[model samples]
Target: MTNNKKRQRVPHHPTSTLYSADTSRSESSLKLCRLTSNSSFNDNSTADVILRLYVDSSSPFVWDSTAEDEVQIYLHSDLLHRSKYFAALLSDRWQNPVSNINGINSDNDKKFIRLNFDVSSPTPSSISDHMTVLQLLYTDDFSSVINSVTVALDLLPVALKLLFEDCVKACVKFIEAVPWTEEEEKRVIEIIPLIREEQSRELLSRLYAPDDSCEEMLNGLIMSAIHNHPNTASVKAFVAKLLREFASRESARRVLERAFEESLKVVKESLEEYSSPDFRGDTCETEAIQRLNLHTAMTNGRHLVWLVERMIELRVADSAVKEWIEQAEFTVNLQRTFRDDAWRNIVPGLPSVVMRCTCKLANGVAGGTILATRQVRMKLVKDWLPVLIVCKDNVSPLVPSQKALYLDLEETFLRIISTLPMSDAQELLQQCLSFSTKNLEDCPHLIRAFNTWFRRATQPSLTGDHC
Candidate 1:
């Protein structure tokens, strides 16, 4: 019973017998060993290294060129060191010798030996054939061989560099998949500066490429962001900028907010597009304002995340809606008060609104007319998005009628006299005009009211600064 317990609890470092490249024959399988000890290790007596060799069938090997396969080792680590069969190394691992072995194409200066043998065998003829391929590595009793990667990198300077992007990506994948410890975390912090900007750009540029493979590069970026120490700041900033510069405003905004809250400049800019609510043409409604309204209204009661997720879930089958979402910016702290009956008044008499522009020079993107056809669609639905936020500074309760809604709206107008955030306030006022423009016929009374007041207020004798 004690022996069984010991066996169960024993920590075993598998012994290995690595195969080496054949000097006489051209074909052979290479092997490696994770050496634990040297004194008693022998290839014939020990079976230590376990392996799951992954190989691509299509990679110049196997029957067809499309499949991949893996071989599992039901053994120990010690067996690795005794194997001597060698093949070309592709990625630190011997490329399946059965396939076209591709070790250092020219660096074969005995880092490996060459073997050119001709044999066509589809499968292992017997168990021994497979076992025979497990060659043992040659070293001066293990203790003499220096396998320290740091020492190797220093001795062979080429080993210290990271050139193949795929290498960085693979390492990053392994890093992200594993949990980081404080010590490991510190190691990453120290490593960031050693990398060059151009090299980083080469990796970052992949994010903008027009292909799905870009996702791999993006993963590398996100993983890098996990270490946000001062050195990582540059990489982090570059990544955020790449997201902003390449992806849609919506996608960029989401990534920005997710990466780091305090560093969401891209998101703020994107939201500005929606917040301005102005698109200069005479489409009757400002695309931005209507968009914010419909979206804000739809998710009015929910948190911002809920609203975003709901949009994703709804997958609203409308082109404009989709575009608005793709392009909408997320800067506002979207937590507005949407009482149950809030939509009842503003929406019933809703104007297909557009924001007017104050630009004297020709404003192209910022100019005249954006179509709010989507807002018109939203108006048909019961949901509402408020374009004008009335921080009703000590005002009477909003009455339930159009008169009350307008009276409160008039308060918004009066605030103009008080000088609000001029840019936003001006933008809001212009949007109100677009709303008025669309519903001109319905608000004739209100329009007429304004006209009458304008005529009286602007008369030559009337000189109050309020005008």
Candidate 2:
């Protein structure tokens, strides 16, 4: 086809001018400029091919009319043949006889090809992209041109369409080596399918991830934040926020549960060893190892407290509550260790650290952050209450925070106690007498517990009261 041949106009802007200058100036600007610095490209006198590009207003590729809708460029068939798309067009089968019409004689010396920007696909920068790729065919240094991901993305689709191997390779190489913004990553994904499979391999790797990869990564972060990181406070806080904002609550629950179990295991084993050392014959070595065990237990107890807090915050503490309730042996070992004078000098914060785990879990159950069943609630307080009493009795000269923790926990235990059967409450409440102070007003939680119990105990039976 030729530029002068009659064709259907674009529907959206049928009469849109290629250029808006007056007729005299528009005629001169029709030949926009030569596109290449190559000596052969600059000399149109010997050029045998004319390339015409025009946008159809109805075409999806057309965007706002910031540039001219049509353009004509002078070209040499040899350099234009670098693109496989143009090489096919310039071959013998496509050539047609020159014809005369409108009393204008055809320029038999030059071959004419009209390239249309209209296509099934759409892109706002299609015209500029094609123009740039065509300009690149005559140049060797592609790095200077395809410098950024945006520029590479713009030129890549056009290069692939033209089957221009060099430009395609250049675009892909630049993209592979550079980092992308979030938006640029989206663009790279969009263009991946249009390129050859081998060409797209590196880009695919950048975006590819195994199934459940997100959960795996979150699990690692949670473990590192809780166990491996030296800066525990800030990292743990950040990880806690991540768990809260994670899309899958069940996955976060699973990750937190795994971490909680691991930390609990370490704390349990350490306390167990400290309470009943598997003595070697050397007394001094055994004592040193026992001190190390207490320190390990205390350190892991702090980690357990953090993990419990996160589980409660996410409402995924059901399993943790059950597990904590079932640790009757662990609690026993902890009580035995706390009763000794040895741990006071080795790990002064051990009692408070251990009780914080119990306190947070109990508070969660009491406050409804974690919805434990009646049985789980009962066993939780039953197993850990003795540990609390032991710490209160044995760890003296309590810091303000430790005293506050014990007070808060005593109240939480009392609150949980009120939820059980009177028989069960009666059994548990009697253990809470140690919570009372010389001044009864100071132990309101204790006072309220007994008051509520007596109030329920004295109520007339429903079966007999109905008459």
Candidate 3:
């Protein structure tokens, strides 16, 4: 779009009589006296119509929180045409305009129309100053509307309510420009329900969205949206897209790691109290569950699974896997208290499935007579073995209750070897054995399980070896 189009899109608010005054006069001279309980506008000689704005007197706009303290402004009735809201109020034939008129006071021969503005704000600071709202109402000065994020947010609904499209656009523009920190994102998400227009909602959603250049920013937006709207399927699907993008970008690997790190921190804090010196585990279960809010835990567990699966696929680094395993250890204790499907699937089922698939692939290569097949198998196993080993070593201690998890992984390992020709199976077993022996002495159960599978599988291979 050209500058003229941009200029046309954002309505300009020029100087007007209500706010702007002679440079020689001080600003205080232009300041309208804040109305008090007994104050009434004498519209007789000065203006054609006295438009009274009755906000929550408690709102700073009225100086005091009382019904009689309505802010009164004098303006020509034709000015209502500038605002669609006011125009409709006066022109709507079916609506009872007379009912809206509280009373008419004829002062100094001018007609005064009294109407309640009813601005909603529970506290004084919650809404914008009455004078600023009035200035925007009558004049075209919108520069102050976008001055601050808080002001912009507060003004948006008012702008929409008063049919101030220009101010609404300006607010949207301001929101787009400002950096939406996590807290601000949450605030924006919460207020989404209050915005009535589809255009405005889409604009706000776009503001929350990150551009393609920053994967982490997009990740953060998705996380925030998912956090706020956990049940929304669209938000969850967006998360999957973000994960795929994160996997492809080598630079985003650290960003992905950091996001998981922050999520794990929440998990850590929730479980930390249980490990405290003073607390006995018996009574702490209920308190712990409350602190580890079920919704958040489930979301994080799903996130954990998503991150781990991507990390494994991208082959970024084993450290992320290790960190996740460490976090999963705390979750093990929860199995005794809560047997959630998502938690179980992530904690053990997924990892077990991964190993099973890897084992099957290695087994296929072993039975292949072709040299290329065997070479491909060797490279695949060489790259995958350490990751499998780390998971096996770390998770075994973490989830001891799930004994079958280790058994399945061990059995899968043996199945791969058994399918291999005797020599190939033996060599693969030796590679695993060496790694386990060096790094995983403490995981005796896994070693023993591996040894048992190896022995059982190897015996048959040995007997048929030369046959």
Candidate 4:
């Protein structure tokens, strides 16, 4: 589009006088504020609109990211038309500036930022006044203006000292608009907070897609979003939604619990740290934080499934878990694939099923063995068992009642034994019951349980098995 046909810009004008319903023009101005709050941009100006990005000085990756954000906003929102953007950032105590964002398309240092201010096209005289003012602001200030790219780097102190809200806002908005790959996303994730509540929410909304790729990298987004702007409506909704996912899948649920717990620890610590020596003194901010904490806890209760339902209930977000469950269901002729089904089908005289157990190790080497109990879970792919008894140790001596659970479980084995009459199921059970403790090996219960299960659960119609 030619500059000749482009719309005109609004000139700088500020009002010191107060406005009230008693005056017609003042009422109109109040209406504008309401409109702007909802619509973001006005037909006249984006002067009040702010985009902020919080960048870390220590991160080399943030330097370019911060500049890109600023440039995106400058390119999209006209400076002459009254839009502002900046990156708010933090630095180490010894660091000169928290972030350094100076990649301003320098053709031997011409500061291409001026090109954006020029409004791009030659146009009329009277309407050009607004553009002219901006041009002057850009040119005379060649060395004076903080380049959007440079501010995050060499000029963050000056930017903040000058309260350069516009530059900060632009950077954050650019992050919101641009798509970031996983590698790129991590670099910019931290600063979502130092911006404002509104900008942070925009960032998380973008991050919370929960795509398979997103699942792995959600920590930075969730932690920073909740930490900086927990009160934002968007953030509130997001936390609740995450809790739902946690409740759904065991893996996701576990991660969610840990994250929520960490967040709660922080909250509790802050309350303790900032507490006054009164009997729970009343105040708005504290009350708000308290209410938020309560809401999260209450939500967790409603959302977290009990241990029995946790593993058994059918919510499988992980590919591996889904595969295991599918195989488990197939034992009942439900035909769920266990492992690679084609491979397992060829096992001669065997039940064409695969059961694998996983013992998840904690972190490094020494966090091993006994610590692996919570991690050691059994996967009965072909038959996840009508019941899976996860215990402190799978073979802890069965209590009197637990012994009954074993005796009672014989019904399943007997039923199966009755069906597999041609096979040695009956003999297997007799030997299993009388099996020496020395031969129990690593799977005494499993052997005993299989014997009991075969005898108890019977569907007797197998013609070829006898062959």
Candidate 5:
């Protein structure tokens, strides 16, 4: 049986309105009162404050008989004073006595406070949120009320507006401890600027990263996927997809190039040690160490092929193409290693693995996936063709798959040679005689290459066509 005839209307403050106007008639029938029976919040006889919550007139919440635009609740000044805003407002009004507070009864001692909100700005949930925070003022166990990110986000701004430090800290702690949805994260970002730097440090740390930290992380992931992970195949595929979808192509390029260079270095050093004249002896220790070196080279050679495919897929293999072309010393060591009979018994797959690395790069160049220059195209074939010839000569009679690998590489090399100058093509094509098979048709790619070379060689010069 609260009396509504004593309530007063108020002038609008920009953030929250506070004013008073006389209203002699009761509007209790039109007003909603959300008065809870909890002793801490609803001791009406002892309560000194009546809070009237309302939406701004311009707000879109349709007010009708069933849904009222405002609600009323009785509160204690001592509990409301826990908020600095209320403490200041109550102290000022008590000392200054401005006509009468919004809903205060002039004939009695009770105070009235009106809080109006634009439902569209903060949110339609704002009224509920403010009421929730005011209820929390009477309780010490904030954890029970502030249980979720949505609850925290809803009440945090209200708490901050009321200058309620404890409730603000509670909301912030809840938000910081939980994971946020992307929409929730955007809300957090929007709220960040409103919070003090010291208070928002942990939240900010989650969103901010140093410039090169991402590149370093990508580099580490690449290495770990290729070298350290026990489940290398699936992990490498996963890492490859990450590189493909990474936002910065340059960063992806730099990370892949670094990994490619490192793998190439290991392969080169392993083969150099294996082919070194010093390790060529048949002694048990030397042969055992040689076997280890060859195995290391073969394993890393597979890694190198994987990296090359990723780089080409990303169109970042230009550097790898150049690096492969410049591997003269490595190729020489490879040829020497293949010429030896020891590796045949120890790692029969080593030659195929090494030549596969060469073939992938050459095919990328030939297919124009990697736009290598004429000199790159020439030296690429010049440097690696001998290794291919040596592998064919020294390895077991090729399995069908291995023979197809060699023939495909031979055709790819000839295609690249066709792009080079006549004399360069002449030297590289002569080496392809080893590519011949008993059935001439089996080697048509080689014949096509030679015929194309001869047609170009015999064509009358465009400059000398006058006669």
Candidate 6:
């Protein structure tokens, strides 16, 4: 019994071998030892350092209960020295070399140095809560490095407070290496202000910025910025840069057009109601009315015109731009409200914008060829001539500039018709005549052009045999 008790007191285990001053280990051998070891203080051998880890019931790492309120684990001083926290504290404690100090309890029976740590339920609950940090600290199991990112993020502050640089780096590398979900990105952004490391925040920002894979996220971030910080110069610059990029992408253009259409709806509704006799009030009722100056902006035509010009400047495909313009429901809306005395005149340059897009369509190159296809030219003429004719008739009391534009349009129409085969030209002219008669309008210029062309076309001199 006496020999067994003595054996228990002076443990002969791997932990004892690790801290044995008599044992000599090379740096590489020590590294290998650390890499292979799973237990914190291997073998429970003659422990020179005792760590009394007082933990809440939530702790995931198990410890022996010494008393009702105390839990303890025996460790080697050499292993504890690996941590900067313990290294600094032990350095101070060694300078004094006192067995007992006030506020620090000691066990005379154990004959070992003691350090106390308090981990509560609220902070640093367990290895479960900070798996990355604890894994980095205790084991070679780095498999959790990527999968345990939230654990790493949570442990960063704790690691920093503990002065654990290795753990800090592990947390940062975990964050940097992994891709983030949208919610994780939002959480990171929320916590950015709290992080003291400038480099970490920069890494986070680089990660958060939208790439091609996250265009929707980019749009959402921009809208959030506009809503939350409308006057921020950096945000405005970002928006401008993003707008330039989006101008060339059909999907992005469609999104912008949809947003603009909705905004237009809000503004127009408010303006239409603003003129009503029953609408007399100074109080703001709807958000759209309160925030959007629809009457002023729409009346001056600056907002919509700027959007159209941007599309033009970006050289968006002419057909797509024209289709978007049509989808805006602008002509239909304007027709309904234009006759209202309340409407602030017409949206200026509306016709000019359409005409410019038409010209671009008339000049596009075909696939595998440098010249514009004849089919495209015919389609352009067929689509636009009718619209111009209607605009000339319905857009009331045409100004001199608009009338001159109509005349030019007539000239272009005749020139286009002249390029077609006689049979096709005759058919197109007959169709034009049918349209003129059905609409009950005396378009004398159009009728005269069509009649002269038809008469010349049937003269039989054009289709003579060439022997």
RMSD for each of the candidates = 21.5, 6.2, 20.1, 22.3, 7.2, 16.6
lDDT of 5 by residue, 1-467 (tens): 66442233332221221111211111211122223333345345555566666656555543432223455666666677789988877776655432345543532554444333333333655455666777677666777667778778987998888899889999999999999999999999999998889999999999888899899999999889978999998999899889899999999999889988998999999999987888877799997898899888888888888998898899999999899888889988988888878878777888888778788888888888999888888888988899999999888788988898898899899989899989988988898899998999888998999899989989879876765
RMSD after Cα superposition, model 5: 7.2
Clashing pairs in 2: none
Off-target runs (Cα >4 Å) in candidate 3 are: 1-45, 51-70, 92-100, 126-130, 190-467
Q: Residue 207 of candidate 5: its Cα lDDT?
A: 82
Q: How accurate is candidate 3 locally (lDDT)?
A: 0.49
Write one digit per residue (lDDT tens) for candidate 2, span 1-467.
36652233222221222222124322423333334544333244554454555667765555664555565554566777789987776575344423211222234554444344442237655555665676676666676567678888877888898899999999999999999999999999999999989999999988998878888999899888877899988998899889889999999888888888888898888888776747433589898988788888888888888888888888898899899988889989988888888888899998888788888989988999888898998898888889999999998988899999999999999999999999999999999889988997889989889999999999988987777
Alpha carbon lDDT of residue 96, candidate 1?
Answer: 29
Task: Give the per-residue lDDT digits (tens) of candidate 6, residues 32-65.
Answer: 2244344443344445566544445545544443
Candidate 3 TM-score, C-alpha based: 0.38
- Clash counts per candidate, in order, are 70, 0, 2, 44, 2, 0
> In model 1, how large is the Cα lDDT of residue 417?
21
The alpha-carbon lDDT assigned to residue 173 of candidate 1 equals 35
- The true-versus-predicted C-alpha distance at residue 354 of model 3, in Å, is 20
Compute the lDDT of residue 283 as modeled in candidate 4: 82
> Candidate 3, residues 174-283: lDDT per residue as tens digits?
87677776776776676666665664566566655655556656567656744667575677566657666654566556656666676656545543443334444446
Q: Cα deviation in Å at residue 219, candidate 1?
A: 9.8
Q: How do the predictions measure up, each by TM-score?
A: 0.21, 0.85, 0.38, 0.24, 0.85, 0.38
Candidate 6 lDDT: 0.49
> Model 5's lDDT to the true fold?
0.77
**Candidate 4 residue runs with Cα over 4 Å from true position:** 1-309, 315-399, 418-421, 432-467
State the lDDT at 143 in candidate 2: 66
